[model samples]
Target: MIDDKLKEKVQMLICGDLEAGEKAQVELLINESSELQSYYKSSKLSWDNLDNLAGIEPSKSFVTDFWKKADKEKNKGFRFFDFFKFNWKLAGSFAVFFVASAFFINNYFSDVNSGFTFSEDVEILNQLDNAITLNSDSSLEVYGPW
Candidate 1:
């Protein structure tokens, strides 16, 4: 039986999880010891043989049935709970879309002028283009000299 420390390191080496320096050190140690070399060889062979095993593929409906069964088991005796288990992400996205549509429609089709008008502000500024003064007796009223 391989010791625990060497067995663990051998597994790490076989799985390619060891650093370059640690891998070189382990290889050197294994080469110097016949018992470790034999253990590493067997471990490496077993690991490599795993890739040669055949893979089993499930039917296309296997995942659908699996989730259905899982959901059924989750709400086994409480049928009312299933009604509240719908996708929150889909519901939240729809709520956001409706809110955004309402906001856009309110702003775009409203008769009230509640938004900023850059042209109006620029006209007001142009009316006082050179009316600013730094005098103590002057009052800086809107769009007029005082």
Candidate 2:
């Protein structure tokens, strides 16, 4: 098998892309190596086949039909229902996500302030048989119904 460097040079030579000095060097090597010579012939044949290829022409009505299709699409207006027509799954997922987020927020993250009670001190005070009052001189006065 030919080495990679020599094979690349041979391909470049077949495509006429090699410089003058490189072309002469590769040609001399090809003449000496039988394997390189056969490789060069096959590469040249492939290149010639590619060079002979011609593009197929479009049908006579292709341009007119294309323009008619383009104009029809251009005149068509976008509708709100078009989003659901092609993307029902995406819309459904969004709806499910919104419902799940609402449930999680309401159930897992309920209002902590609503659970608090500021009337506990007053309830305890009412439970006492005697009333405890704070005097203006920072003294405690215990009094009852008298």
Candidate 3:
């Protein structure tokens, strides 16, 4: 039933080049010959099946490794100290010392201005005694009559 000539024509008609007269001839031939019609039906089904299945290509197990790599990259955490790469401890220590020195110097100057030293008060008392002795009425009064 599937002779070589009709097979060729079936291949062409499947590819969409057959004219209306050619299709009508094929249809008339199919109705009059029962075995030809069955063979043609099966071949037409095969052609239609191939046409429906075209332009679809599936890759093999494509997502497993891709997802694993993505998860690994996602779980990698950020390092907080990465940007300050050099002399981090030195910078921190310098900042601490600078702040302490500023605080100490400010307090030292403030204390110096607010408190009186013992030596300064004793010198002032001695100057007052000398001035009083120079203005006394008698030699015995050089030292005040205590």
Q: Would you list the rank order by TM-score, best first?
A: 2, 1, 3
TM-score of 2: 0.51
- The runs of at least 3 residues in candidate 3 whose Cα sits more than 4 Å from the true structure, single-residue gaps closed, are 48-146
Clashing pairs in 1: none
Please, what are the lDDT tens digits per residue for candidate 3 over residues 51-112?
77658566665688788888997787665555346878976887799999999999878768
Models, CA RMSD each: 12.2, 9.8, 23.9
TM-scores of the models, in the order given: 0.40, 0.51, 0.32
Give candidate 2 regions above 4 Å deviation.
Answer: 51-54, 78-146
Give the candidates in order of lDDT, highest first: 2, 1, 3
Off by over 4 Å in 1: 58-78, 83-146
lDDT of 3 at 142: 60
Worst 10 residues of 3 by lDDT: 76-85
